[model samples]
Structure formats: C-alpha cells, structure tokens
Target: MMGLSYFWIDGGTYLGFIVCITLLMFILIMRSFDLKLRRKFTRVAMAMIIALAAGALELGLLAKGDTSTLIYAALLLKYILEGYMEIAVIRIVGRDYKKIQSKLLWIPFIVISILICTAPVNPSVFYFDSTLGLFVRGSLGYSIFIEAGFYLLVGLCICVKKWFTGYQRDALIILFMLAVVSTGVLLEEAYIFDNCTLTSSSIGVLFVYVYMYAERYNVDSVSMCYKRRCFYSDAAKYAKQEMAIISMDLNDLKYINDNYGHQAGDVALLTFAEVCRSVKTNKFILYRTGGDEFMILGIKSSQKEAENLISIIKEKLKETPYTCSFGLHMYKPGEDFEEAVVKADKAMYDDKHIYKSNKNKQANKRDDRFDEKVQSFSNDIDFFDEGE
Candidate 1:
C-alpha cells in the first residue's frame, strides 16, 4: 500500500472490484458442483484465482510505477497461471494435452521468466514512467508479449482442434474467448485501454469453465470421442436431418492384445481414435460405443461423405498397428434409429467377414507355397541319392 497505487480509490477501481468479485463467486459456484468436476477443474480454479490476485497486485503498481518488484511478481504469476489454465481445460476436454509439451520451448520460457523477474537489475524488459506515473514496457517488453501470444495460440490450437465433444460450436466458443483476451491485452499494451488484458483473462477463464469443463460429461476419457450417451442423445435429435451413421470396429484387437500385449492394444485403440478425430469435420461427431466399436453421426451426410471420411482414416492406417472395418448407412427421417443402427451393424459385420476372409486366403496361399518348396527339395535329394 505504501508504494502501490490504491486501485479501489482510483476511478477504475470499481470495475476491477466487480471483475474480482465475479471471479470469486465463480470459484464458489464451481465448488458446489459435482465432486468429480470440482476435483478436475481445481487447477483451473486455482489459476483463475491467481490471475485475480495478480490483478490486485497490478493496482499496487499505479502509485509507485518505478518499483518493479510487485509488477514483476504479478506478471510471473499471470504467466504461470495462464499455462495452467490452458493445460487444465485441455485435460478435462480429453485431449492428449501432453502432445503439445515442448522441451525446446521450456528452456526459453524459463529464461525469459527469470529475466523478467529480475527487472530492477536492468530496465530493458520494463521500466516505470514517472511522467505518466505508470509502468511502461522496456526493450524486452515486446518479446514478453510475443511469448504470451504464442502461449495463447498454443492453447487455442490444442482445445479447438483436437478436444471438445461438440467441437464445431464448442470449439468456436473457446476461440472467441481467446480472441477477446488477446484483443484486450493488445489494446492495453497500446495504452488505449487501462488494465484491459487482466480483466478479459478473468472473463475468458470463467467462460472456459462454463462451456468446456462443465459440459465434459459427454467426452470419452480413453478414446477422446464422445461417449455413447452423448451419441444416442444427438442421434434422436438429428433424426430429421440428412444424417449418415458410420459403424466401425477395430480389426484384430484380440490378436493385438494376445500377441503384443494389452498395452499395445490400447495404443492401437488410441491411435484409431486419433484417426477418427483427424477426419472429423464440424458437421460430424464421433463416439466410442463399446470396447472396439465406434459410431459417427454426421449431419447432412451421405454415403460418399462417409466413405471420404473413411478414406482419410485409410491413409493413416500405416501409422498404426491395427486396421478398422466400417459400414455406412444414411438415416432416413421417421425411420427407427435403432433399426437403422442394426442394419449398419450388419453391414459392418459383412465388412469384417470379408476382411477375415482375405486374411485367411493369404495365410492359405503362404502355406501352399511352403509345401511346394518342401516337395521340390525332397525330389532333388532323392535324385542326388541315385547319383544323378
């Protein structure tokens, strides 16, 4: 309080107080929800609270803009919490968030954070403008912004592209939130808005809770698809639309589990899930119905569209140890969804039958060739015994 500006007494203090109170209320509301969701989003709650606290510290800097200690500490907390927020959202959404971890970026981020923290030793990263009575960017200020921009973009890409059950509409919500926060930060940096970025971040984090984490009941944790429950609910709703339902089963899952071990089978299953996710468009939703079986509900879809989606998976078949067989059916309005599903299932079994047949034929052919080679060798030996 001695050196820092009194954020409340200032004209802008009211707005900050309102935003901070909202964040606190949000934390309490989330805690009252399902126990599992509370445990799941604990990191997000912590991160948002830390961000709020940083904003409070930020107000302390208005009085003593020249003192870099409080501001630097605030910034450090903000950056760390930003990372945590992204990771938490991605995790709850069932994305393999670990795939984005980069050992290469870690060193640079650590170095930059350390450099920014030691602001008093040198003023290149940031300095207090006594004339304006505000903290201004030093030489490395732009670099810090760039790094923040990179982090925000990474978070967006992780969630928007790979996670979220209803990715089309849901992913857009995430993208929009990120954009709002980024715009606020940019405006603040340009001195157009006072303390805009921090406020925007608090709002965005709250939205993330409501849109992504709160609605995660449908997301499948193991396969990263929507659960069967999600699929059935949407199927009934989309019955009137020109929908294509795809029934698929992983080929030879039992063989993989027996020969290579269950872990390998899991990898194969996850790999197939990734393939499904890769081919998914905004019009489609994928689900894991059973152990090795999956379904996709595609709006305004056709057999050709379904085949095209399958083709994309075929291209990536080389990347995995397993292959999948599928059947496509166009769901007619007024038709029993279960009947249509049964037909699609029959079609999938036909495909599986063909797959196994081909495999067996190949095996038989190999055996025949082996037998022929052995007979020829025996005849040659008999001729040599007769002294050719």
Candidate 2:
C-alpha cells in the first residue's frame, strides 16, 4: 500500500498470521465446550489474536515503506493488548478476575498507554526513525516490557502461593504458562527470534485449556472444590507432614433439597465451602469429598490449631443460613492416613449427632409453648361459658 516495489511478508509476519489464525480456531472450539473461566479464556484468546494481527500488520508495513504514523499506532495497540493478556491470564488463578485488585493492575497499562499516545509530541516512549526505516525504542520504551513482566511476576507469585496450598498440578500448569509467555517475550525483545511471541502465547493458552479441562475431572463442579480423588492424593502427599484432618458435613442438606430444591442445596454447599476457604491458610487445603461432605487438610497443625480453625468456621457459618458439623483429628507421624480419616469421620458424626439433638430440643420447646397457649385459650372459653 505504501508503493514500495518489493512488499513481501517476512518470517515474523508469517508466524504472526499463522498464530493469529490458530488462536481464532481455538476460540471457536473453546466456546463449544462448557468450561469454568470460559469467558476469561475466550477474552484472552481474542486479545492475543488482535495483538498478533497488529504485530503482523506493523511488520508488513515496515517491509513495504519507511516508518510512518500507522506503523507506530499498530505497535502501540499491540503493546496495550500484550499488557492486557498478561493481566487477564494471571486473573485465571482465582476470583480476582473482576475484583478491585485486577482493576488496580490496569493502572500501569493505562499510564503506559497515555505515554505512548503522546509519542508525536514527545518521543521518550517510542519513535520511528525514517532514515533507517525502523521503529526505535525511546527512553520509556522499556516501560511496556517492564509492565508485562510485572504481571507475569504477579501470576507466578499467585501460582507459588497456591502450590503451598496443595494445588501442585494446577499451580504447575500456571507456572508453565508464565514460563512460555516469558520465553516468548524474551525471544522477541532480545532479537533472538522474530514474530515468535504470538506463537508461544498461543501454545501457552492451549496448554492452560488442556489443564483446565483435566481439572474439571478432579474438581467438584458445584462447589468448585477438589474432589474425592484429589483429597486422597493430597492426603497421602501430606501424610508425612504433621497434619490434621478436619472433616465437615453440612447439616440439613437433605432438608434444603426437599424444601427449597436441589439448586438451593448446591448453594448451601458452596456457602459452606466458601466459609471454610475464608478461614483456611496456606497450610490448609479444602476438598469436597462427597455431596454435602467436605474435608480440610491442615499441614503442620496441632489439635489446638484445628480447634481454632473450626471455631472460625463456625462463626462464619452463623452469618449464612446453613451450618456445618466438624470433626478434627491430628495424625500421628506413622499412623495410617485412612485410620486418621476414619477417626475424623467418627468425630464428625458425633458432632452431627449433637447438632441434631440440640435442634430437636429446640423444636420440642416450641411445640410445648404452643400447647400451653392452646390450653390457656380453652380454659378461658370454658370460664366464659359458665359466666354466660
């Protein structure tokens, strides 16, 4: 379009176009599947495609003619999209995707964007060199990479934190993602390779999707907590550690289902799980082992710590309409893990028994009050009849 006789695609543009098309296909396939965080995945994939397309366009323009405003604008858009992808990918780790923390992470991107927008007036962020027909980084040009790296670091930290919480597989998957994207960015930035960033990112997104798809099998769909197999696996993994098992069961789940519907029952389970999560630490891992039954494995915990954990959970449960009964058992260094689980199970059943007994007692008291009021009314009626 710029009227250069030789206008052909370079290696970078070819790779970018290829990666962009692949990402578009990935998005289509991803939409067909029902996955948790599906929207977030789609958003990042779309952003990646856009970024790749912009990068390819800039490369083609650079090949055709001298550097111009259009090329600079394309570069700016690519940077912004890259920054967004970093932040969005990190958000997949937890619930922060739409939270204030995620929004706060955007501040750096906004600042960078404003600086890039004023490049015409001030070339400190980035400028084009017409003499060499090249795009050159200005003083603040490094800011974009620094910003992208900051998000990658944040994502890596979150994954590391989750690793300590017994999410080894999930955390490792995220770490792999960071590694891939970081390598891509390094390759492009260091001139080691051209137009490979988009390809690497696309591969990373695919890996994450595969991991997430596998994760669904190990996760409780309703509560989004680890399932029975994960619990078993983690229990054995932490068997040598000074761990405590906290077994919990929701009270009146059947009642909720019968009276309010199964959907309400699901809400109760989710609520109980959330309460447990709120009180859990890095030393603790929460699992939904069965319907209305959950467990927490607390690493390096004492009986007293388990008690405090239960207490905190109870207080949180009071705010919700549902309640949970808990049983705590500290594992001896060499004790059978299943035996320890059984002990915890027994304790939980005992707690459940107590909870049921107290509930029945309250019900009986209400019934007794009703009977007395009825008797009092009947006696007053007989007295009025005699007086008449």
Candidate 3:
C-alpha cells in the first residue's frame, strides 16, 4: 500500500540514484583517468544506476496493485540488474582473475537468470500472489543473495591476495568498502530496512572514488611513478622484514636541461623510469624520490639478485644515450630502514664520484693526444723551413 512518495521518502533509493548519476557523469567527463579505469568505473556506475532504476520501477508497479504482466517484467529486470551489479563490483576490485575463472563466474549468473525467467511458468524463484496482491519468495528465492555473497567473498579473496603481495594499504581500503556493502546486504536480508543493499553499494563506490582521487597525490605526474611521500610510507611497512633498497640518480640531468631543454630532461627521466619498469619484477617497486633521484624497494630480494638487477638496468641503458649511478644495500631484519637508506645513499655518492673520476681521466687522455699531434706538426714545419 506504499505510494511513490513513500519510495522517495525512504531516501536510500533516491540518494543512491543521485550518487550513481554523479559518478557516471564524472567518469564520462573526466580526462585524467586512463581508458581502462574509465571503462571499469563506467560499467559499475551504469550497472548500479540501472539496478536502482529497475528497483524503483518494480516498487512503482507494486504500489499501483496492477495484476498486469509489467510488474513481473520489472521484477525480473531488477533481479538481473542486481546480479550484474555484483559482477561489476567484482571486476572493478580485482585484476587477477584468469580467463577460465572469469568464465566460471558467469555460470552462476546464467543459472540465476534462467531461474528468474522460469519463475512465471514454474514459480521456482518467485511467485506473484494475485490473491494477496503480493510477491512471495519461492524455494529458490535466496539464490540471488547467495550469488551476491559469493561475488563479495571472491572480492575479499582478491584483497587478501593483494595484502600478501605488499599492497597492504590498498587492500585494506578495498576490504573496508566490501564490508560496507556486506553490512547492507545483511540488513536487507533481515527485513530491518529496505533498499539498504543498493544504498550501501552506492556509498561504497563513493568511498572508493574518494580514496582513488586522493591517491593521485601520491603519484609523480612527470615520470608517472610513485612520489617521494609514498616511498617513506611503503618502506616503513617493511621494517620487520628483510628488504633491498637501490638508490639511483641520473648522471647529468642538469646538463641535459641546460644544454638541451627542460623538456629533453623530462624525456631522460621518463626513459629511465620506463627502463626500470621493464626490468622490475612484481616483488619490486619504483619511486621517484627527487627531481633526478629514484629508489627501488624490493621484497624478499637477495644481494646477488639486487646486483644482477643493477647490471640488467645498466645493460638496458646502453641502448640509450643516458646513464645512471646506482647503490644497493640489503636491510637486515633488525636494522633501521632509514639507516639502510643512508648507507645506500653513501654508496650511490661513492659510485658517482668514481664515474666522474673515470670521465675526467678519459677527457685528460683525449687532451694529451691532441697536444701530441699539434707538437709533431709544429716540428715537421720547423724542420722543413730549416732545410729550405
């Protein structure tokens, strides 16, 4: 007997629609995000908006007490859109899903869709009671909840995987959002509130958007690498474990800028970053700590492996016209991370000094050869004049 006003007054659906529409517009209009990320957010925002809109349609039809087929159609569309929302959430949060595992996720969705479609004929998933003017849950009515819960659980597993792989902060944020959605679902299932699930999902999406937007500050826009602020934060997380730190400084960044242009200097920095990314494994992270300074933090890497990585980087740089000075230090389990970084810094300076000394020696040798050639020519001219 609830009217359309009651549906709007509930506030959950209305608020959710506003949030979703805003997000969709932001995703479509924003130029800062990559295509892949824009696509992900777009899918999620569209799915949520559609799902909430379908819910509203179903509610409106139910309020009218119409025995027409439109109510059933509306209900079916709502259920299917809800399922898509679950799938879209999963896709947005995780990137490790394999092709086979991804295909398997669709199986449950297909089964739920089939069950929903059959409800009109077999009354398996849900049945409309014209006598009571109400829709009643059937034997398989709980399938949608189960399916949604399953997707949430899968998302949790992905978060845990990220946690163990050294992305603790990011994983924690995602887990918190999933927990919010989970609470909403539990509340709705308990009949304590209506539209709690969709509202919660919208709120979760908002949190993620805010968190991601804030994360932009942690990235260095020039080189597209993590900034100095994140380096200290991420390094502190490895205080209790053995870690490897590599300090790198470009050899002649100022020279490049003064001789060429600042734009050329930026190209050199980006080239270095691209090479580092190519040689870095999943266990390593790159951070640009200063204008010409960068650092590599490695998890569970040995000294030999670190040295080999340096060699690989040097070899890669040979393909270009630039070079970098490097220093490697292994941080023991009980040692201070800052002290290890200091040692790495000292080593990098010593290496830089050696590079400069070698360059000067080669320049002196070239100068001596030029002087000898000039002296020999002068002697030849003098001897020819005396003979004449």
Candidate 4:
C-alpha cells in the first residue's frame, strides 16, 4: 500500500514537472512568433508554475502520511490560478465575455472549488479508500463531471468563436488545456478503481507540453473568407450545385473617411454589413475581401436570377443611408473560378465609379447653393452700407 501511494505521488510530481518544463519552452517559442506576451501568456505561465509547485507539495504530504493545511492551500491556489488564467486568456482574445453563454464556463470552476473545500472536511464521505487503505481524496464523480463540463465549455468557446471570427489559435491552446485537465481527472478515477496499474496523468501532461511547443514554433494560419484557399476548399466541393456570387464595394467610403472621422467611416462599414445580413435571401456566405468591399455567395438558378437577387439587395441599401455598388455572377460549368471572380470584380468597380461620379455631382450642386447664399448676403450688406 505504501509503495503504491508513493508511486501515485511520484507520478503526479513527474507530470507536474513535465507540464512546467513544456510551458516554459512554449513561452520561449511564442516569443519568436508575435512575442507580444500579451497578458494571457503571463497568467498562463504563472498558473502552470503554481500548479507544478502544488504537485510537488502534494507528493511531500503523501510521504509524510499527513495532509498538511499548506498542501491543501497550495492545491486551492493552483486551481484559482488556473481559473484566472483561463479568464485572462478569454479577455485577451476579445471574446464576448458579457454574454450569457460565458456563464457556463464559471459553473465548473465554482463546483470544483466547492468540492475541493469540502474534501478535507469530509474526506471519508467525498473520497473512497482503496483496498490497500490509501486515502485517495477527492470525489471521482465531481472531478470527472466538472472536468468534462469545463472541456465542453472550452470546446464550445473555441468552435463558436472560430466560426464567427478567424482568430482561433489561442482558443485552440485553451482546448488543449481542457483536454489535459480532463485526461488527468479520468486517469485519477481509473487509478481509484484499480483498473489501471499506472496513472496516465503524466502522459497527458506530456502531451500538453508537446502541444505548447507546436503552438509556439508553428506559424499560426488565419482563416479568410473570400481567399482562394477557403474558396477552393469549400466552393469547389459545392461547384456541381448552382451558386450565385454577388460582389459589392461601398460607395464613397474613402471620401467619407477623409471628410468625416475614421469612427464615422467604421460606423458606415458596420451599418453596411448589418444591412447585407438583414437582406439575406437564402443560405448565403458573406466575405469581406478588401477595404469597403464585400461579397455574398448563394445557391441560385441562373445569371438572371443572380441579378434579381442583387436588385433586391440594392433596394434594401436604398432604404439605408449608405449605398454599395454590386455585380452578379453565376458559377457556370467549365468556368474558371478565379477568372469569374475577376469579371465580377471588374463589374463592381465599374458600378463603383459611376456611383462616385454621381456623389461628386451632388456635392458640386450643394457647393453652388452655398456660394449663391453667400453672394446674396454680401450684396444686401453692401446696399445697406450705401443707404446709411
């Protein structure tokens, strides 16, 4: 029994060492990429360091046959540090932390903290003593349940955030952390049940280290909407089906930014995007290609059908303050995708030039009205002075 307990303690400490070393290496490698360290990196490193120290202390307590208050404190410290690190990462990633969905993430941390608090006070009730009579503290049910719940939260955050925005590399790292913690909890349960001769937590921690190394050294690729990569990967698969591509560019966007502030320019862009989304006819994929340029692809019947859809979009924009120039193109059999895109782009540019010309003409008319007013006021003042 003593030998087995020693083995578990040693295994946990080894796992902690592996996790810490990997994290340190990961930090060094991340510096090579963006090197910003941001706030997320600092918190993550601190949390892992504390966890490693706690694991060492846990082994010490096991060897002494007395679980000291300091060891318990260290364990709680590790949990709190890890939880805060996750929250920090979420903030640094600029996710919608105020949303209701984020509350799900806190639930596991809260439950786990409560369980760990109760474990020392009610060890016999919470934990099961092994056949060898070792007091393997902490409830397997709560541990596994909380770990799995956290994993789900992290995974959902990663997948959903990536789907909406292209920034997902940090989220992927969070997912890796979730996997490591989950595997540790599961292995601990297996060890408690005597189903496993060795705890696999160390191996899991090692995997986490490898993932960190990969994240640090590897160039993280960003997902783009209209880029050739995503288009070929997704559009080609749907090439056999009818697809309508509508290309658009915001009218007078540069003029707006130059006349007004950039903030107003941003508002115009956001408003245009919202208007486009609201005018959705069917299942459509929207892409922002260049500055003030966007495209919407939908499954449609023919070129005329695509034009009708663009006409509807134009009507929707007419109701709004901003206007956009649009061009429609339907994917035809044997048509090169890039060439078709270029044709659509050229059409949109032609429309954009026409819109800009009309806008300039209107501005000239307004200038003429202002000049007429100024001349009439000056003539009236001169006549009044002569009469005096």
Best by TM-score: 2
| TM-score ranking, best first | 2, 1, 3, 4
- Give lDDT tens digits, candidate 4, residues 110-147: 76666666655676324323343344544443563555
Model 1 segments more than 4 A misplaced:
1-55, 64-99, 129-132, 163-166, 190-195, 255-262, 280-282, 311-315, 356-388
Q: Which portions of model 3 show Cα errors greater than 4 Å?
A: 1-9, 96-101, 219-225, 232-342, 346-388
- Screening candidate 4 with a backbone cut-off below 3 angstroms (N, C-alpha, C), the clashing residue pairs are none
Clashing pairs in 2: none
What is candidate 3's lDDT per residue for 314-355, written digit by digit as tens? 999876667899999998888878889999999999999998
Candidate 4 ranges beyond 4 A from true positions: 1-26, 29-37, 85-151, 154-184, 192-243, 263-286, 296-321, 357-388
lDDT of residue 141 for candidate 3? 81
lDDT (0 to 1) per candidate: 0.66, 0.74, 0.75, 0.54
Among these predictions, the greatest lDDT belongs to 3
| Model 4 vs. true fold: TM | 0.61
TM-score of each: 0.71, 0.76, 0.64, 0.61
Q: Clashing pairs in model 3?
A: none
Best of the two (1, 3) by lDDT: 3
**Model 4: which ten-residue window has the lowest total lDDT?**
379-388
Question: In model 1, which residue pairs have backbone atoms overlapping below 3 Å?
Answer: 4-60, 5-63, 124-139
Report the lDDT tens digits of candidate 2 across residue range 146-253. 788777778877786666655677788888878887898789878777656776887787788767766778888677689999888987887778888999999878
